[model samples]
Each structure stands twice: as C-alpha cells, then as structure tokens.
Target: MDAVGLSLMNEAVGGSEKCVSAVREAFGAAEALMIRNVSQVAKDFRCCQTPKDHQDQVELMQSLADIVMGTVQYNEESVLMSISDLCGVMTNQSAAYNEEREPYQRLVKLSQIYRSSSEEPCLDVSHEKRVKDLMDTTVQSERRAERQWTYQTCTEFGFYQTCEDASCPFSGMVTLRSQTEICLELFGISQNSLPGRVAFTNRYYGGDEPHAHRVLYVNGGVDPWKELSVGNRTDGGEEAESVFIRDSAHCADMSRGRVTDRRSLKNARQEIEKHVESWLKTAQQEKKRTE
Candidate 1:
C-alpha cells in the first residue's frame, strides 16, 4: 500500500479500536464481550462496503466516539440504557418493515438485560443531540417531499387526486399527501416551502448497485415508496431481496404487535428472517473462506 493508504487504514482501525475499548469498559464484561463478538462479525463485512474514503470514515467515527464519551453520564449505566431503548424500538420496528423475528436476537437480549435491571435514565447530551438530529432530518425530509410533489404536480400536470384521466390507476387512491400544503394553498396563505428535492436526495443510508450486500428490502403493499424498492424494480439477487407485506403500512413489521396487524404481516416477517439467516450463513462461509 502507498503511504497515504497505510495512514488511512491506521486511522480507521485506530479509531475503531479506541471506540471498542471505551465501550467495553463502559457497558460491563458480559455485554462488552457480546459487543466484541458482534464487532468482529460486523467487521467481517460492514465498513468495507462504505463508499466513503477511509479518512472520512475514521474521522467521523472518532468524532462520534468523542461526543458519546464526552456526553455519557456514567460509564456503568447510561450508554447501555440508551442502547437498550434503541433496541426496544428495533424490536417493534420490525413489524413496521414486515420483519418477524429478531434474527440474531441481539436487541431482544439487550432489552431484557437492561430493562429489568436499570432505571429510566435521563438523556445525556449525546442522546439529546442524536434525537434532535433525527427530528430535524424527518421534518426536512417531509418538507422536501411536499415541495417536490407540488413541483411535480405543476410541471408534469400530475393530478392531486383529481380523476381527470378516468383510466389512471392513481386517480382514486392518491390523496393530497400534504394536507397542510393543501390547506395553505386553498386559504391563500402562502407558506415558504423548500424549493426542491435536494434534501431528500442527500439523506441516505448508503449507495445502491454493487455495495449493498446482506441488504433485505422489505416494503408494505400499501407503501407509497414501493415503486422505488428492490422488489418493485427487479428480481432480487442472492444477497438482496425485497419482500412486500400485504395490508401493512410503512415499516409495520419493525414495530411491536398491534391487535390490528394483518396475518400477512406475520408471514412477511418470516420471509425477512429467512433472508437474514441466509445472509448470516453467507457471511460465515465467506469468513471461513478468507481464513
């Protein structure tokens, strides 16, 4: 490797090692041990897939660790508790996404261990910052989508629920997604909306095409975003499959059970678990091959 490349590798691994050490000390031995194992499993494939250069990845994660450690209230409690809360959300989040089982059961285990033993901890600065960031992102995304929809309507002459073309499939089902915008426009109360979809275009988990392995794309039949999904666009390859949950809304499988949840939702999650296990086996086989 070139000197620059070596430096990048050193930085990334160094930052990651520091983070692992800090977390191990903070979360306790058993949980920490699990973290280490999961870390190992993750390292088998996770960071390698990122398109971001190693320097950027290292610096970002290092900054994240610095912020987390700085804001953490107590080493023994807060971080784990916060993580447990996140895991609890994940358990319920599956149903929303048409997911059934926990797969590895990591979140379930974390929830049990922390919820039973710990008190409700106050949000540390790190938690507050993360939550606020998410809220901001969500609001920004909604604004962008609304603006884009409006622009598309005006430019492409897309109907906002009007059945001008009687044969159009979207005529009846597609309502004004933005009630607030409709109310504003109808009342002649002009509110400043974002100009375009730049914000939405930028907000992402990662890229598409080659880097997305072990990625399960689950969507609901009723989901507006179904057209943009893997299942909608193409037949799934070995590592990527997008399954649709019938009669479910967005991410319905990711959340906890509701009495209202459809039986099809349950079946959808079973399919998700099957995909996840397949991914795990793939990862293990690849690891063995490398070793």
Candidate 2:
C-alpha cells in the first residue's frame, strides 16, 4: 500500500518518536538490501532475451520488490526479516540451474518470502530445504479466511494495490496486469473479469454511499484504504457518522489504548464509544416500546 509507506515516512505523526525512529531505521536497512537484490537480478536478467521476455522478467522483479515493501501491517522486525529473506533467496542460487530455470526459482523463493511474511500463502513452494523452512509446517487457523478473501478478490473486491503511481516508493513494474496474474493462476479468474466483478461489488454495496441506519464509519487519515470508505454522507438522507482519525495508521484506534497513541486516535475511539452507547440506549427504548 502506497499510503502505508507514506505513513511510515511521516516523521511528524502516525507513530511515537521512538517507534517512528525504529521503523525508519529498519525500513532504510531493508530498502537498501532489496535494492541490491533487484540490481543483482537485473544484471543476471540482461542476457539478450526477446523484448517480451525482458519485460516479463522486469515486471516479475518489480512485483517481488513491491511485496517486500507493500505489506499492510508494518512491524520493524518483520520488515528486516522480509529483506533478509530476499537477500538470502537471491544469493542462495546454485550454478546447476540454467538461465530458463532462474526466473522460476526466483518466483518460488519470492513466493515463500511473501507467504512467510503475510497472513495468506500466495504461490506454492517446492524447492530447497531452506526455502521450505520459511513456510510453517502446521496449517494456519486463518487458511479458510485467507482463501475466502482471495475468492472475494477474484469474484468481487479486486482490491489489488499496485505501485503504478510516480510517487510510489516501489518500482513501477507492479502494474494492474502484474497484480492480476495471481487470480488467473490460483483461481482461474481472468484479468478481464476483475473490472466487472469489482463494479458489481461497488454497485451492490453503494460504494461508501450505502443506505444504512445508526452506522459509524471510521478511517485513519494516513491509511490508503480510507479512500474506499465513507468520508462524508453525500445524500444527506441517512444520519450515518464518519470519524476521520487524522495522522493515524490503519485501525490505529481499534488497538489497545497506549500511552504512545496519538491524540487523534484516542479521540476517535471516544467518539466511537459514544456512538455505541447511544445505539445501546436506542435499542433498549425500542425493546420497551415492543413490550
């Protein structure tokens, strides 16, 4: 998520001074490693291939780099681990592999890194013992949830975050086409079908303009997902409330109340609590009426 990266870079807000310093330090170290891995991959990939082949390799490298940087929940240790994995995978290549197998090998290693780092396992890996160790042997409790979310992406949500914008910290290689390739490979969902599916989802839910009652919508100003949420009620029909937590990260207010939490997040949680209290009182009154 571009917004996640931006939030990490915001020295003035989002996190406490110590947390922010640690994040920046970890991110900087990881970024340097990732860039080196990219450069090495690029150098190896420069063997006179066809134009299409070159483009494909370039895109693949970019997609892998994006994964290293685009993890939604950024923990300092996790960032360091991801970059370490990238560096390990890139440098662990054997001389036995021919040029043709290089890309496939890289794909497997990158997929392993992604799965080990994220909630959902993306590409399946069947490679070296080192790589196999990266994936947990035991099945995750969230397997079903991850699969359901993947299915949603294929059939409805299509919430693919690509680094296409010029200001994005990741390489521009992460295009819409590159992002959707997984849908085709994993779920047989074609890229052509995604736009329609996403449209249907937005239409069905009213795309942040839903006709609902007593609903409280909350979003963090620095979270990119906020763009898809109800910022303001346009129809002026339903009295839906939306609270924007300025200078906060995703779900910052939902976390346990911390001394390090910004003032905006604390206030947002108070506002949410007020709404919940009001709703409880209204429900009690309705029950009394029915009785």
Candidate 3:
C-alpha cells in the first residue's frame, strides 16, 4: 500500500510539470501571433514595421494576456475593459492613416485659410495708419528705438509717463543722461575727462502739433530725454546702485561747459546738440590718433 501511494504521488507531480510547460509554450505562441497580426495591419496601413515597433506590440499583447489570465492582478474586469478600449484606439488610428488623401486635402485647406486670414488684415491697413498705431503707444516707440542705442542706455530707459493735467503735456520726456554718463565713467570709458556725448532732450507740449516734441539728433539718431533705471538685488542682498549713480555723475560733469547751463527743456536741446558734435569730433580725433 505504501509503494502504490508513492507511485501515485510521482504521477501527480509529473502531470503538474507538463501542464506548466504547456502553458508557457501557449503564452509564447499567443504573443507571437499578436505580433504577426499587428505587423500585417501596419503593412496594410503603409507604416514601417520596425523591430522596436514589433517588440512594443508583442509586449503590450503579452501584458494584456497576463492580466486576463490573472497572472497579473488588480482588477481583472478592468483589464478586460482596457483591452477593448485599446482595440478601439487602434482601429481609429488605422482608419486615419488608411484614408490619407481626403485628410491631406483638408489639412492643406485649413493651412491656406490660416495664412490668408493672417495676411489680409495687415495688408488692408494704410501705411500712415500702421505707422500711427505703431507710434501710438509710448512703450512701442521706446522699444523700437532701444536697439539703436547702446546696451547700457537701453537698460537705463523707461516707459513714457502720461499727464492729463492741462499744465503738463500729454507726454513728458524724463532725462536720464546724467545717470548714464556717470555709469559709463565708472565703467572706465571716460577716465581722464568725460568724452563729449550728446545730451538727451526733454519736452512737454500739448495741443495739435505735428511734431509734439523735439528729439535731439545724436549719432545720426534722435535722443529723447528718457531716464533708464538699472540694477538689481544681488545674491548677497547688496544693491549695486553704482551703474545709475555713475551715469548721472557723468551727465552732470559734462553739463558744466555747455553754452546753456540750465537743465530746462530749451537748454536740453541746445546742450544735446553741442555734446553730440563734441562727441563726434572726439571720436574722429581718436580714430586718427589710432591710425
């Protein structure tokens, strides 16, 4: 009886091993079949069947089977539902690729509509109107003029301030030339005597004037009295006010020898012109000296 019982136990063990091996072989075959189906579908859709693509699809299908077979657990019903959803997505993507001609035409039409709509309004506006709109905002004018100035000046300039007070003009130009010059000197540009640079003009005017304010001519460009503020809090919590302070100092020093000693709007125009000419002359002399 003991020997018979031992033989029966051995038979049961062998049967279990065979079942496990069969299941593994079946899983591998099912995975391969899924890959083959996906490849055929991709080929029909004229998409490239790359090795990576095949591997991805095989893995996906195997994961799906594992969930279905309860080899991977968490909600078996949810896994089954997800497999159906994946099939729907694949079908839609396949359809989109297969009917390529109509979709391509629609895309081309949409792009044409976008291009036409974007360009037509811009072209419809008159040149004068466009210029007026561009200049209407003080910030816009400042931004457009900024690149013409040096990087330091660009950083120093600020937006225009509007005044509704009848005593004041619609716009007021604030001079920051003194600030800029001081900073330039500190940077070692004007070591000996401050180089003669153009003074910026500040103007306040109201009413119907074509040129509401006079912009000073400097280096073949206009210089308006605009204060540019710069500096930021450093990591060490120290404020580097040297940049603005130096610029203001330079401006004050240069203002001393000017024909008009005042900082008024009228003096600003004359002084700026004189300073500009001085700067040009100095530049030419330096060039000749170097040559």
Question: Could you list the CA RMSD of all candidates, in the order they appear?
Answer: 23.3, 10.3, 33.8
Error of 3 at 221 (Å): 22
Q: Model 2, 1-291: lDDT tens per residue?
A: 566555545444423333223333333333343455644443332312222343444444454554544433322223334322333333344563343233334544445546565553332211222122322334553345545666788898887777676445444555777667656765778989898999988899888678577887888766667866788653543347788876665676777887866677788899889888988898899999999
**Cα deviation of 69, candidate 1, in Å:** 40
Q: How far is candidate 1 from the true structure (C-alpha RMSD, Å)?
A: 23.3
List where candidate 3 sits over 4 angstroms from the true fold. Answer: 1-263
Candidate 1 residue 60 Cα shift, in angstroms, is: 41
* The 10-residue segment with the lowest total lDDT in model 3: 217-226
lDDT of 3 at 134: 33
Leading candidate by lDDT: 2
lDDT of 3 by residue, 165-216 (tens): 3222111111234223333333344412222222221122211121322222
TM-score winner, 1 or 3: 1
Better of 1 and 2 by TM-score: 2
Per-model clash counts, in order, read 23, 0, 13
